[model samples]
Target: MTTALLPWSKFLICALLIGLAGPVLTRSGDAIARLTGLSRSWIGLVLLATATSLPELFTGISAVAAAGAPNIAVGDALGSCVFNLLLLVLLDALSRDEPVYRRVDQGHILTAAFGIILIGFVGAFLLIGRGALDIRLGHVSIYTPFLILLYFVAMRAAFFYERRAGTIAFTGEKGTETGLAGAVGRYLAAASIVVGAGVWLPFAGLEIAEVMGWRASFVGTLFIAAATSLPELVVIVAALRLGAVDMAVANLLGSNLFDVLVIAIDDIAYTDGSLLASASPAHAGSAFAAVIMSGIVIVALLYRPGARFLGIIGWISLSLLVVYLLSSYAIYLLGH
Candidate 1:
């Protein structure tokens, strides 16, 4: 029995460690933003987003490099894309005063746009087939370079736009430089714990897939995706509790941005065939689902709908939740 439960036990412990470190990361990130005179949105976008996304990054590398599971690598990245957007629904419900879309800066639409473009590119390629292009620099897909370039372009655009918008104006009293350094140290320490947990996650996931007779694609898309995304879940909730709405929103959106970039990196690490090409084509469902979800977010950010559906979630959140569930179901059916 103990041997049978080992994978489940490892998964639970990794998840526990990730959840435990989330709040500390949040607090330290908020402090770094305050002390460094950076906007909460920027900090959340680059710093917090990257920190929280480390799990997906490492997991993808491990999945492809060690486990030789390209589907798990790709599924984890794309599934995390969908999973991260679904987080907005949770943020929406928790805000209480108004819809989360209404609380965040419209500038986020830029981040959301970039996420859509990147995700759409992957989905389209998956459907049309990457081999059709016959464009490969060695083993990696031609799409890899484009994805990497676009990610940096997106980051540059966001940084400049945020600066021009004065999002980094630093309105509050700044902390001492020493305080900032301390916060950075603490954040790194907490992140190290998350990293350790993330590294073990894929192995546990692989074992679970084997033991349960589940598809690798399904396991990656749902089970492993959820486990890897635990930090984003906790960070967003902690950010909300701290009243950093923009930070919370940015973290989710920025994580999406980072998630897509992981695909390109995974392509490079795969070293066999193209990463996306090796993945189950069913992942397109999740990719397009995430794209639609992002479009909903853009509309909500623009429309700022105030009315809640059944006085619980806004119409947008309802739409998001529905899409997430349907996509997961489709992946499950396809996996079976």
Candidate 2:
């Protein structure tokens, strides 16, 4: 019966499934973090980031395999970073605390800064490797093992600093007291649904973009980016529900860091040389947007004032994101 549905109907169903899967996976991840004695920030960076980002990975691989459009895949990953940071501002606004930023461990701030630097490095490499020198290298030789090594080093440094500072904490409610074993089972069930959804949503998204006369980069930067960030949204809401504002702030910031590092993984997967070579100029705009959003996040975290102030920042960031989106659309129109 499910197999008999039309393509668009199937796509909508899949997108809904992915949305449903996100909360379950997030809750289960919270449980596992408790069970295994891991920090929420670590879980946010490693598990939640990875699980939430599965959709991007799936869509990117599918895009490359089916259309050979490596730019779409790369754009989707970076664009997800922008979306995740924007989620931070949303979380801050929802929190009941004074300054949501003050609650966050300083290590997160450091990690985020490093992430920004790393992304800048990647962007610089791609931008520089654009022309004649790139051709001489046969293909853009930006994807080197050294890039991956540097990423690891940065990550290890962040982890070590967080641990040494004794600021890492888990803010979720106790799973054991809440019949979490049963919740885990449900989480598993939901996760299966989410995986299936992730697998199918990209196809639907691609089809929708085609019907709307949009470019692949546009589909990836906006639609697919928002879809894959659903888990962060869930995590933020859950944190607010439990008054775990720190977790909410940390999850958003850490997720951005994770997204930036995902570029390293994508680089490894992309055997076709530098990702920039195949991308349109639209990606540069997306990268700039990401940088702007990242800066806003850093400012909010560093200043750490009151709840009203954080909420104000949230509003400002949201406005900026809207502007970025409109600008991107304008650029797309101009190119067409």
TM-score of 1: 0.97
Single out the weakest 10-residue window by summed lDDT for candidate 2. 135-144
Full-model lDDT for every candidate: 0.89, 0.64
Which digits, one per residue and each the tens of the lDDT, describe model 1 over residues 79-109? 9989999998888888898888888889999
lDDT of 1: 0.89
Model 2 over residues 180-286: C-alpha lDDT tens digits?
56755766677566566666655766676667677767777777777777867876787567655655656666666656556555555555665555656556666
Give candidate 1's root-mean-square deviation (CA, Å). 1.4
After superposition, candidate 1 runs with Cα above 4 Å error:
1-3, 170-172
> Candidate 2 has which clashing residue pairs, if any?
98-306, 98-307
